[model samples]
Target: MEALLGIDLGTTGVKAAIFAAVDGRPLASAFVDYPLFHPRPGWAEQNPADWWQATLKAIRSCLEQGARVGVQPSAVRGIGLSGQMHGIVLLDEAAQVIRPCIIWADQRSEPQCRWMTGQVGAARLIELVSNPALPGFSAPKILWVREHEPELFARVRTVLLPKDYIRYRLTGRMAMEISDAAGTCLLNVAEGNWSSAVLEAIGLDPALLPPVVPADAVAGTITEEVAALTGLLAGTPVAGGGADNACGAVGNGVVRPGLALVSIGTSGVVLAHAEAPHVDRSGPTPRIHTFNHAVPRAWYLMGVTQGAGLSLRWVRDYLGLPERALERWTDLDAYELLTREAEGAPPGCAGLLFLPYLQGERTPHLDAYARGGWIGLTAAHDRRHLIRAVLEGVAFSLKDCFTIITAQGLQLEQVRATGGGAKSPLWRQIIADILGVELAVTNASEGPAFGAALLAGVAAGLYPSVEAACEATVRVVENTAPRPELVTLYARFYEQYRALYPALRTVFHALAGLS
Candidate 1:
């Protein structure tokens, strides 16, 4: 039986999974964690060598698991990769790492973002790239390096995203795919290629970028060195995988129109597949993102919330839940305990609301200066109310994305849920009630790794196309419908949630200045 390997270079770790190419059933999986460096406030970086090391460790562990399950490692037919998007990895002429990779979470390029917007003209920038300049994108990060570290920028011969760098290390090839490249603020999203005009505006050469390809296309074959390191065949094909969210969408079988995906990890994303590119640059508010989908020739609309699960994590650590778990020597998760506590509180949290902008917000509002806190809190509220309010706040933020998507003329029939937050029945029900749409849970638990494996199956010709591959492997496992009474109650609370941002904008800016 032919098998496939899918690897995800995630923010905090690398995950590797082995799957049957014939039916997409997961055979074995392994994960290896890595540290994210925050040398300064609002700055996040990771050493690329650490990612490669983690990838090798994960693959070997996964192969061992497969062997114990009676699957031959040599039967692995193809490899696919998915990872965090917009990270800038610089390489010298000899393909040596120039510096540590600046990841998507870093917010140090705000000044560069403003400079790019000024140089290209805000309206023309949107016209050329189909999105506004933001601090998290690759273009601004490149400009930041050029202005701040001119000597290091001069040595840069090539720029690659997080996964493409891994692909380069695996295959000895320099290439990128459309889905991940779209987030760089360099791609002409409508044309599905790098924008020369934008590059010129930023004084960058087109040669600095990698060759773009479709997400499912075969990028190259594994090198002998990589094969010897991981115990795999040297010539195994490597597919041009996708960005994490794009692969997650593919993993959930959200390839066609009308179906949407809501993924809540450290950050939250609400995405809808589009038959054609839908650019909405008319509004003053930075609302949604238009990017090439992992499905060839297709597009997607995405809205992001920078702090989704992060808010819950902050609360969990603040409440000493993990420490308490350690003391009891229990295998119970801190999030599960938090969710159980939330269940004790009534819906709406008796007028208490939370703003989940711990790392600033992205969707609807593009304010990096925004801060998070509990509003409408009273002496009557307790820990249950605080936990419930956090959950409701996240749901409310996603609802903001849903409202914008509907306003853009895309109809959402059912929302497929994925990621760490989806495991909670309470969170799923809360999202359903808040959005007033049914929530679906898929059978694939590995998220992007499963999607990457399916894409590898497509590249190997095991399936005729991506859609067919998803249809063969993906299935809806559970459904949650909204309750009428809860939906009515959330409508009023959502109005209050919407007003908090506008009222706090001035105060948030002032607080940021003071800091």
Candidate 2:
């Protein structure tokens, strides 16, 4: 039996999973964690060396597991790569990493964003790149390095996205797939190529960027060195895989129009697939993002919430000491215990609300200075209310994305839920009620890794197309329907939640200034 391998290079770790090439059933998986460096405030960096080491360990471990099930390294037909988007990886002439990667969550490029807006104008930037010049994008991060660390920038011979760098390490080739390239703000998203105008405007050389390939196409073959290092066959085809969100969409079968994906990881994302390129040019900055989809000739509109699972993690780390202690003796997870406690709280948390801007706000409000807190708390409320309010607050922020997508006239037919938070029945129900839509959970709980495996299957000729591959392998296993009463309650509470951010904007900025 043939098998496929998928590697997901996430923010905090690397996950490698193997799946049957015939069907999408997961065979074996392994994960290896790595550290994220924060040298200064609002900055996030990761060493590419760490990612490579983790990827190697994960692949070896996963292959060992696959071996127990009668699947060998030689049986692996293809490999796919996916990772966090919009990160800049600089490489020197000798293929050495020049600096630590400035990842997606880093916020040090606001000045670069402003400069891009001034150089290209906001509306034209959208027209050129199909999105605003956000601090998280590759172009702005490149500019930040150019302005702040010119000596290092001058020695940069190539720029790559996170996964593309991994691809190079595996294949000994330097090329980027279109789905990840679209997030760079250097790609003309509509035309599906690097934007010369944007590059020239930013005083960047086009040669620094790698050639763009289709997500399902074979990017290159695994080199003999990587094969020996990771226990894979030399010359195994590597698919030009996607960004994490795009791969997540594919994994959950959100390929066609009217289908959406709601993923709640460290960050939350609501993405709607579009058959045509849809640019939101209504304001100075587009409320969300429009990028090339993993599927050829398609696009997706994405809205990001900087903190989703992150908000729940804050509760787990700071307030759930009892749950953590219980976890040592019990099989239950700490997050599960916390969500169960939240079940005791009534809907709306007794008028208490939380702003899940622990990492600042994204989506409709693009403010990096926004802060997180519980508002309308009363002496009568307890810890249950605080926990429940955090969950509700995250759902409300996601609803903000859902609202904007629907406002653009895309009638969503089905919304697939995927991520850590979606595993909680209470949290899933809360999101359904908050968004007034049923959430379907698919069997591909492996998320982007599963999607990457399917893409690998396509590259290996196991499937005719991306949609065909998903149709054969992906299926909805369960649904979470919204409670009518809770939906009505959330509608009223959502309006109040909507008001909190605007009212607190000035104070949030003031606090940021003081900091």
Best by lDDT: 2
Cα lDDT of model 2 by residue, 1-515, tens digit? 89999999998799999998777889999989999888876788999999999999999999999999999998999999999999999999998999999999888888899999889988788889998888778899999999999999999999999999999999999999999999998999999999999998989999999899999989999999998898999999999999999999999999999899999988999999999888765666788889999999999999999889989988997886464447664777788888888898999999999999987777889877788999998999998899999999999999999988878888889999998899999999999999999999999878899999889889989899999999999999999999999899999999999999989899998998887
lDDT of 2: 0.92
Q: Tell me the tens digit of each residue's lDDT in model 1 across 27-105.
A: 9999999988888766789999999999999999999999998888678988999999999999988899999998887
Q: What is the Cα-based TM-score of model 1? A: 0.97
Best by TM-score: 2
RMSD of each: 1.6, 1.4
Error of 2 at 178 (Å): 0.7
lDDT of 1 at 265: 85
Error at 181, model 2, angstroms: 0.8
Alpha-carbon deviation at 188 in model 1, angstroms: 0.8
Where in model 1 is the C-alpha error above 4 Å? 322-329
